[model samples]
Target chain A: EAGVTQFPSHSVIEKGQTVTLRCDPISGHDNLYWYRRVMGKEIKFLLHFVKESKQDESGMPNNRFLAERTGGTYSTLKVQPAELEDSGVYFCASSQDPREKTSYNEQFFGPGTRLTVL
Target chain B: AQSVSQHNHHVILSEAASLELGCNYSYGGTVNLFWYVQYPGQHLQLLLKYFSGDPLVKGIKGFEAEFIKSKFSFNLRKPSVQWSDTAEYFCAVSWDYGGATNKLIFGTGTLLAVQP
Candidate 1:
């Protein structure tokens, strides 16, 4: 099975510009999550999606950040009016059903997208 | 709010040397622990996890961690370090919030350098 994959491994954009990061999770996985690591800071959760419906978005920093999982397949995180602090690596992950007793259901991560805002 | 702390920001060791990294969390309920590693130019990957049962858990690549509930600690250890093991390690915790939603709280990473 293919691991989680992300597009545009690196992105550079000016402040106030809008940037979209894409994540394609493993096939048949029902859980998708987004996290980010800022400079000199810990990786923090952004949001989670379960089959096209957002399960939790409480970690989103502000109104300028938006995430979408339209068809329960892939996810997209969009940052509008990006600030300098938005520069960091964004990681996406997916896992099988947590309720499945047989499978450990560990999350598989993708090669993060490094965003640089100048 | 749940939080995690990794006491070491960086560690350097020679090959074949023993390794230990300290991790602690502040949560007053049942929790799951995890350790993730990210090598240079690579994505973060799971090194080990602790859900229940034995407090001592072993993972791939000869790594292990001991969970001490009383001290709220889950420390990673390895008997011998290898140059290829140089990477950034993050410790995280997931709380059982009594629902299907499971979120993780991560600590600032520790960069490990194994000298050859």
Candidate 2:
């Protein structure tokens, strides 16, 4: 089984430009999540998808950020008019739904896309 | 309101030395704790996790973590460090959101440099 994979391991874009990061979770995994780590800051949760439905997006930083998971497969996070503060690493993770008897869900993470806004 | 903290921002140790990294979380409800390591040019990988049962959980690569509920801490430990152990370690806590999704809250990682 392949782990989570991300596209464009590194991205450099000018401020105000739009950038979209893609993530493909492991096969058969139903839960997908997005997280971001700004320089000198902790990694923060962005959003999560159980299948194609958005479960919780409270961690999203602002309105300019958007995430989508179509057909319950892969996910995409788009940042419009990116700001300097948006420069950091964006990580994607996925895990199988926990069984009724199991309380643990181990998440597998991707290599992460490093976005640099100048 | 929930947060994770890793007090050691960076650590330098010689090979074969004992290693310990402090991690603390502030959350009253039930939570799952994890220690993740990212080696050079690699993605985040699970070092160890604590869900329940024994507070001491052993993971791959001889890594272990002790979860202390009273201190709200899950600290990573290794009896002997190797040069290959140099990496950035992140401590994270998972909490249910709306009782549906379990999102991870991570701390600012600690960079461990093991000198050979």
Candidate 3:
């Protein structure tokens, strides 16, 4: 089975510009997650989606960032008027539905999209 | 706030040398720990995971980690390092808050360089 895949492995945009990152999870996976890693910092969780509905979004940093998983297969993270601080690597991961398995499921990660805001 | 910490930011080891990378977390409750590896130009992959039982877990490519509940630590180890082992390693932890949030808390990764 194919692992998680991300689009535009690298993106460069001017500050205040808009950018969208896309992620396609493995087939049949129902849980999709978004994470971000700033330079020299730990990777932080952004949001999660169980199917088309969002399970938790407490990690979302601000209002300018938005994520959606329409149809529950793939996910998109959009940043409007991007700021310099948003320049970093955005990672998308997915896992099997936890309800099906008794143990916690392992997440498979994508190559990650490196976003550069100048 | 709960957090993970990797004490070694970077490490250099000659081939065949023993390797050990320290990881620790600050949470008193039950946690599921994981160690992930990212090779150059590759996706992040699971090296091993600790959910419960058997604290010492072995993973692919001859890597292993020991989880010490008392120390709140999960350190990665290898008896002999190889050039192919060079990669970035990340330690993460997750816990069920009310109903298994499943959000991973990761530590700043440690970059390992195995000299051939």
The candidate scoring highest on TM-score is 3
DockQ scores of the candidates: 0.71, 0.72, 0.75
Ranked by TM-score from best down, the candidates are 3, 1, 2
Rank candidates, lDDT, best first.
Answer: 3, 2, 1
Quality class of the docking in candidate 2, CAPRI style: medium
Interface C-alpha RMSD, model 1 = 1.5
lDDT of 1 by residue, B1-116 (tens): 68999999999999999999999999668888899999998878999998888999999899999999999999999999999999999999988766666678999999999999
TM-score of chain A of each: 0.95, 0.96, 0.97
Residues A1-118 of candidate 2: C-alpha lDDT, one tens digit per residue: 7889999899999999999999999999999999999999999999999999998899999999999998999999999989999999999999888543276878899999999999
Q: Is candidate 2 or candidate 3 better by TM-score?
A: 3
Task: Write the number of the candidate with greater DockQ, choosing between 1 and 3.
Answer: 3
Q: Per-residue error at B56 for model 2, in Å?
A: 0.9
Please give, for residues A48-86, the per-residue lDDT of candidate 1 as tens digits. 898899999999999999999998999999999999999
The pairs that clash in candidate 3 are none
**Candidate 1 pairs with clashing backbones:** none
State the lDDT of candidate 2 residue by residue for B1-116, as single tens digits.
89999999999999999999999999667888999999999989998888879999999999999999899999999999999999999999986433767889999999999999
lDDT of 3 by residue, A28-107 (tens): 99999999999999999999999999999999999999999999989999999899999999999999875543577999
Model 2: per-residue Cα lDDT at residue A114: 97
- TM per candidate: 0.97, 0.97, 0.97
